[model samples]
Target: MLLDLINIRKVRRAIVYFGLILAALFFQNTILAKVPILGVTAMVIPCFVVAAAFFEGGVWGCVFGLVLGIFYDLSLAGTSLLFTILLPIIGFASGSLVMFFLNRRPLSFFLVSAAALIITAFCQMFALLVFSQTKVLPLLITGALQVLWTLPLSFTAYYSCRKISGLDLSK
Candidate 1:
């Protein structure tokens, strides 16, 4: 009976997380993308992944990352497997780092989220930089702008997941 209850709690939690990802996906593609800061959209997905992974642990982070990536890939154009490959790694790394090294705090989230955002922005710009003649200065500026724009909003993910983590599953 206790095992079944634990499984049910986990399933419910998974469902909630899945819904959160889908909602974020909708917000990202529809509302967030349209609002450009310095001609660059805020990539909120990384914030979601990093926050969840940080709060949930490595396995949950990986699973959410994979799901988010698959949907993200399907949503975007000309970027086939980019996020499908990257977010999971970021999620797993973020989760593992939190599990072993970092404490659950806002400062830690900021630092880790910033690092993840930097890597994501670099990978995105690298593809364009390599394939085309986009200048380094412009790409760097845009990436920095994106990170700045997205970082503030990342608190939403942090607080939300923190609340989720606080839930009493033992009940």
Candidate 2:
């Protein structure tokens, strides 16, 4: 009886996460991309991963990060499998922070989300600089703009995941 209940909760959690992923993908690709801030579009996927990890733990974070990373890789043209590689690490680290030290709160979410975004932006900047011979200043500017633009939405992702995590699956 207990096992059955646990399994049911797992299923419900997965379904909720799937729905969030779909919504995030739609928002990121369609609406968010269309409205550029400083000519840079927001990459909101990392924030989602960070928030999920913040609430859900490292394993769940890593799993969803991989899933979201695939979507991210496919959505952007001419990019290597960067997010696929980076997001899982980001998720795992974020989750580990929660497991080891941090509490689950919006402030924690904000800090983790910002760190994740900055790391991703740095990785992206490094890739552009090394591979394409892009100028450092432009790459830095774009990456900074993207991080700044996306940071505000971390609250949304945080609250969404927080609400989902707080659900009473047994009921």
lDDT of each: 0.90, 0.88
Worst 10 residues of 2 by lDDT: 162-171
Candidate 1 pairs with clashing backbones: none
- Model 1 compared with the native: what TM-score? 0.91
Lowest summed lDDT window (length 10), candidate 1: 162-171
Which one is best on lDDT?
1
lDDT per residue, candidate 1, 1-171, as tens digits?
A: 778557887898999999999888997999999999668889889889998998899889988999999999999887579899999999999999999999878899999999999999999998789999799999999999999999998888888888887834235
On the 0 to 100 scale, the lDDT of residue 43 in model 1 is 87
- Residues 113-147 of candidate 2 have per-residue lDDT tens digits of 98999999999888669988998998888988998
Q: Tell me how candidate 2 scores on lDDT.
A: 0.88
Candidate 1 error regions (>4 Å): 1-6, 167-171
